[model samples]
Target chain A: MKSLQELEEIRNKTRESVYLRKDRAGIRVVVGMATCGIAAGARPVLLAFLEEIKKRNIKNVTVTQTGCIGVCRLEPMVEVYLPNQEKVTYVNMTPDKVSKIVSDHIVNGQPVMKYTIGVDGR
Target chain B: MEDLSLHILDIVQNSISAMAETIRIAVMEDDTNDRLTVLVEDNGRGMTEETVKKALDPFYTTRTSRRVGLGLSLLGAAAEFCGGSLIINSQPGKGTSIEVWFPMSNIDRPPLGNMTDTIITLIVCNPDIDFIYEHSTPGGKFVFDTRLVRREVQDIPLGEPDILEWIRSYLSEGLNEIRGGA
Candidate 1:
């Protein structure tokens, strides 16, 4: 029932939003949501970030999506692209982990190494 | 097969891949009652009621690429596992609507994964089709649609080199706002 006009407002206003904020350099969280990723539950991971960013009142951190990372079995995977830091890959992600990642990594400047790729602390 | 939410995303994508012109996705969270709901609708090439029933079978597949179609099967499994249910209804010549209900307390419920990639891939692979994605929490709503984006910028193809990057960010920011950005 939504219209094109709503999307137009978005394209116009936010076209320069992210770029303008680049001077501040926010954290970038990319989650895989390919057919494989979706089948593995990437939606919650994305929402987790949305909730955390708002709850913590954090700025500059943006969450996005990516295609198949070639590891379907370990999906719901999240890659944290921190400002000026190496990309950290986290596997088997869930809504719960999203909070930790937000609080520890984005806000506290400490990545949840235990949840990062290959650790599988599950 | 693993997470319910992921399976839900896959089946929804199947509708998009089937050339749905208008796709609707909704996520609702009720913390007070402790529940979440996801619903996806599409006005695309719909299946016969018979086909709709069979599509849920793990071994039934219309695709020639593989032996089976796991999208719906996984969704069925995820829904059942999470103290929830998935209902798929379709009519020949009409469209399909898939609904997933999850008890937010279900420990096994899969995470709500990335949607940005899902929309982008759908946009890139099916340039001809349009997608309307909407996600709403108790607080607000986020929506992304290709048709609207395409209409606004006539000169630039969203898939084009420079525009693609901006388009991607626009989607992320727009979605973030829908979810009540900070």
Candidate 2:
């Protein structure tokens, strides 16, 4: 079993850098996590985003969950909110699509248009 | 949902939606008794007796977005199908607690899939809320309380990548130890 002492060490190692940094306006990635979302496998997609973001050491990006996005068929939906840009809703999300979203949109400020709800015909 | 953990995730979402500040989840697998039980208690806005009664109805929901409220109803059905049961206890302004159990040997009982992912998702998504997760098997028991983690971490947010990774490994390791003994 892992020890809380290790957690303390992690806290120590991470605290300095965290304190040195200024609070900047960051990107927000929200996943739909209602009954429809879970039934359609939103959990993995949400985990994928978290893993991708952590693996790449992307800072200032908050990945969270929302209740529902109104369209039940597009259950596993993801909405990305850039600092000042319009919110981009990505429909029919899967773990496979997380890497590209992280690399293109989150890292390079380019939303993958093909994956957006607009391109998905609502 | 395909598995019990998914049902757990859905049920916890309802608690989060109800503005729960603290939630307790317990999963017990008893080989001697041939039972698998899950208990989730939340310090959220409680419901009236009437609301609790209606909560089991698939067509009943308080949300206006869409008409159907299937989370609790589906879980109740799943429990019944597995020769088990689901019970809800609530008092307005106090809180709510849901207990579900299944016959361990039942072939139809869904597996308790990836709890690590479910827990990680909940913690990361709702960093402010405190979650106490306790899992017990015939061999041993494992308990994880966010309050202790919060105290140890101090100012570091639980959602931080490193912290989240640590939590994931911790839970996986802890759960594996108990399940391995079983």
Candidate 3:
């Protein structure tokens, strides 16, 4: 039975041992998770980002969620922000698309234009 | 909502938008009573009596950008279809509590979906808010609180990849053990 206390202990110990680098000035991946997004199946999309990050052992990238972006019709949206760069908003995101975003955008510094709002004509 | 967890995510958004500082979500499955109950309580800006009355109405909404707020209404319809009821208790300054109960074996009752993602996503999205989630079955119980993690890792973000992954596995493992893999 891993209690909350035990989990905290694990976090504390790992925090010291891992020694995370200070250069997280990396990309930020934000998923829309408002009522509209949730209704459109954003949970799996968010989980997919986390899963891909762990699977690839990627570092410096953070996955987060936000409320409605005011475009409910183009929901399940994701926005990636790199330091000192314009935000690339991806609409109608899915679990499979998350991997490509991670590898092509986060790792290679190129956004997948097809899934983005700029090309979607929304 | 397709599942109880999705409904929970939707309901919690209301609380978050209300600027809730502490939110508690409880899920209880009682075999003896043949009921599955979900309670989401939050110390947020509670709605007025009139607003609460209209919350279950599909046409009513607070947002100006949208014409409808269907989250609560959908959950209410789902509960009613499963021979269950949904209740809301609130005060303007106090807090809000929503209790939903459904028949455990009802054909219309939706299965509880991926709760692990629900919790992790909530925490990751709203890093400042504190969440307490409890799941209780006839066999055992599991409790997760953000205060504990925050205390230990004071500076680190909960959205950190390693920490979020740990939290996810911990929730799934705890639920699996308590439910004895169903």
Candidate 4:
């Protein structure tokens, strides 16, 4: 079983970096987590984002969840909001697509145009 | 949803939307009694009697964005299908408590899949809220309360990647041990 001591060690190591990044206007990644979203496997997609972000050590991105985006057909939807850019909504998200989104859009600042709802026509 | 944990994830989202400050999730399994129970209690804005009735109806919902509120209804169905029951108790300004029980041996009862993901997802996404998760099996019991972690971490957010990773491992290991090890 894991202990509180390990958690304390993690806190000690990461506190300074977290404090430093607190003041910046970071990017936000929001996953739709409503009934439709969960039924369509949004949990895995959300987990994928968190894993990818953590594995890549991306500090300035905050991954969160939202309620329905009103597109039930496109259930597992994701919306990315950069610091000063328009929000990009991605439809039909899957765990398989997380890495590219993280690498191209989050890291390289280049949105994958083909995956956006705009290109997918809703 | 595919499993009970997904149902839990869905129900907790409703609590989050209701602005719950604290959410308690408990899973109890008794092999001798052949019973499994899942309880979720939240300090959120409680629903009225009329609203509670409507909440059980699949087509009724409070949100304009969608006409269907299937979270509770689906869970109720899942419980009923497994020779179980789902009970909801609430008051206007107090809170809401949802309890679900299932026959442990029922073949139709979905597996309690990936609670670690459900918990970690909730914790990291809603960093400000406190979550208490308790799981008990024939072997042992394990409890995780974010309040204690919050006190220990002080200024560090629960959503910090390192903290989240630590939480994931803790839950995975703790849950496995309660189930009599991997």
| Candidate ordering by lDDT (highest first) | 2, 4, 3, 1
User: In order of the candidates, what TM-score does chain B achieve?
Assistant: 0.84, 0.97, 0.97, 0.97
lDDT of 4 at B100: 93
TM-score of 2: 0.97
Clashing pairs in 2: none
B1-182, model 3: which lDDT tens digit per residue?
A: 67999999999988988889999999999999999999999999998999999999989988887778888899989999879999999999878999999999999899999888799989888888999999999889989888888887677777767677668777898899789886
- Model 1, residue B38: C-alpha shift (Å): 1.9
* lDDT (Cα, tens digit) per residue for candidate 2, span A27-97: 99999999999999999999999989889987878999999898979879999999889999999998999
Task: Say what the interface RMSD of candidate 2 is.
Answer: 1.0
Say which candidate scores most in lDDT. 2
- Give the candidate order by descending DockQ: 2, 4, 3, 1
Per-residue CA lDDT of model 1 for A27-104, tens digit only, reads 787878666776666765676676577677565775666656766788989888887888989998888878888888
| Number of the candidate with higher lDDT, 2 or 4 | 2
Off by over 4 Å in 4: none
Question: Which lDDT tens digits does candidate 2 get at residues B48-145?
Answer: 99999999999999899878899999999999997999999998877899999999999999999999999999999999999999999976999999
Off by over 4 Å in 2: A20-22
Report DockQ per prediction, comma-separated. 0.11, 0.86, 0.50, 0.81
Question: What docking class should model 3 receive?
Answer: medium
